[model samples]
Target: MSVDLSGAHWFKSTRSAAGNDCVEIAHLDGGRVGVRDSKNPHGGALVFTPLEWDAFLSVARGGEFDRP
Candidate 1:
């Protein structure tokens, strides 16, 4: 679960507006993904397995996380 993010090439969604508040993501080795707060790059990251990341993207694209 401890993925080294030192060389991570973090980037935010292109759909995101030009602002400071956002989350950054990096595609890691072995198909894993890394996510971290843009405001705190050195804080830490949440690593997700390929399957888990894919499932999350599916729900996200389906608006499952949309506010009611």
Candidate 2:
């Protein structure tokens, strides 16, 4: 699925530090989500479908990615 992100209003998490180093996210049309690196706006991005995004959020909230 090709999702256009040219006009995406990307934003970082509020927990992010006040700097250029962070991840940015944009809620796109069709319940899609966009993600990219703040330090490289022009760099490539990852687009997630609604289901994928939800599953990711579930895992995240479950702390599946917590540091050991």
TM-score winner: 2
Across 11-34, the per-residue lDDT of candidate 2 in tens digits comes to: 999999999899999999999999
- Candidate 2 Cα RMSD after full superposition onto the native fold (Å): 0.7
> Best lDDT goes to which candidate?
2
Q: How many clashes does the backbone of model 2 have?
A: 0
Worst 10 residues of 1 by lDDT: 1-10
Question: Model 1, range 1-68, lDDT digits (tens) per residue?
Answer: 67778888999999887985899999999999999998888897999999999999999999999999
Candidate 1, residue 59: Cα displacement in angstroms equals: 0.7
User: In model 1, which runs have C-alpha deviations exceeding 4 angstroms?
Assistant: none
Compute each candidate's TM-score over C-alphas. Answer: 0.91, 0.94
Q: What C-alpha lDDT, on a 0 to 100 scale, does residue 27 get in candidate 1?
A: 97
